[model samples]
Target: MSEHRPVETWLTDMDGVLVHEEQAIPGAADFVQALQASGKRFLVLTNNSIFTPRDLRARLLASGIDVPEDALWTSALATAQFLADQRGGGSAYVVGEAGLLTAMHDIGFVMTERDPDYVVLGETRTYSFESITRAIRLIEKGARFIATNPDPSGPSPFGTLPATGSVAALISTATGRQPYYVGKPNPLMMRSALNRLDAHSETTIMVGDRMDTDIISGLEAGLRTVLVLTGSTRREQVETFPYRPSRIVDSVADLIRFVDHGKPATH
Candidate 1:
């Protein structure tokens, strides 16, 4: 593809772009393997902040995808880093899981159920009104709101699940303070990912499924955006969206080949 144009690096989403639910998408692992082999670098940049990089790595390996723990960039990690830098270590009320807690703990952020200075939210397998209500009450008082990511929901093998956005909305309603999202589509998340690459923004590409967040983030960060239909995005939806992706394709496998070897399904 034009003498393997010197792409500085690649930033990609995890769930819809690489795998769906707990299952790996067709050739998704292969695509990662190919890019690594071609001397091209890729970081699994994802909005899913429910898991720590270690947990994410283990899950991927269990599912036959071998990714190093440090290769992933998660919303949870970014949030922790952001809050820690903001002197939020005093207290944090989180409505999430091990991933979210692990990240905060690593960054020295304190987690408490009551009287926290920050209220953090993420995807929960068990979201309850009682728990949400408690968080809301605290937020109404004075807690700052932080959303790991603002995904409305995600497709899983079992079924659809409530995304962290719902919790963010709940907190917003209670405190009248909108949450600061630290995940994808946010320039902050993209900025963190770019820091790892240490590359100029002009030569980087952000690939993902969702348009509002992923593609929009690339636009906001001034990076080339590639949209893959294998995730949450469908071709028809792209036609109606006002923002445009620099390139569109069927899946990550095709995208990997096109970027590295100049080959696609040719359909």
Candidate 2:
């Protein structure tokens, strides 16, 4: 490896980079442990807005990865922060789970369906037609639309399930109002996460398995990105995209040494 900048802060995707379907990927635990031991500022970023940081921390612990609650960043949090920054103490008509609701409440947002400032869409296992219908009606009445992520589907124990983007699309088709997605693939999410960590883009590295979301957002946010081939994206699939990652590794395990040594990995 040639001379390169050392990574002072790390941002990593949850599902594919560290774990897959509730199981920790090889070296994931070690990588996180190294980050903690080295006192590097890092956060686990997830597009899933279904679980709060506390809930996610427990889930990760069960899978042999011990991450602090504060070190986990989600689309739900980013959406809430964005809303608060845009218009402090605003209201929204929410269609999601505890995570989304809690984030909004933490930011002093009132959850309502009548004349809301925004119609918020997030990931949920059981997306009710009634709630979605209400959201559509609110949007028809001139409520702005905001969604957590643009992912159409998410993996589950059963199979692929409809996510926020899928529901947002239906609402958009019915109300002719497109949602402002606040999650991955949107650079705002990365900037929000960086702000949360008080970290600079130049000294940060983003690690994830997906090319479209993780790599692009990080690149646009001025952070070096790494694509790990252990989840949704494959090695061959990477070539299909015009953009490329700074480094390609088999898994998070492959980057453990680099992270521990505070050196950027070579392509």
Once superposed on the true structure, which residue ranges of model 2 sit more than 4 Å away at CA? 1-4
Off by over 4 Å in 1: 1-5, 258-267
lDDT of 1 by residue, 1-267 (tens): 233345767888887888777689887888788767877666898777777888899888877777777779988888888888788556898888888888888888777877899888887788889879988888888888889988888766688888898778766876788998998778888888888767667767788888998999988998778888987789889888888888787888777666564333332
Q: Model-by-model lDDT, in order?
A: 0.80, 0.92
Predicted model with the maximum TM-score: 2
lDDT of 2 by residue, 1-267 (tens): 235566789999999889989999989999899889889999999999999999999999999999999999999999999999999989999999999999999999998877999999999999999999999899988888999999999888889898888888898999888999999999999999999999999889999899999999999999989999898899999889999998898888888888766555555
TM, every model = 0.89, 0.97
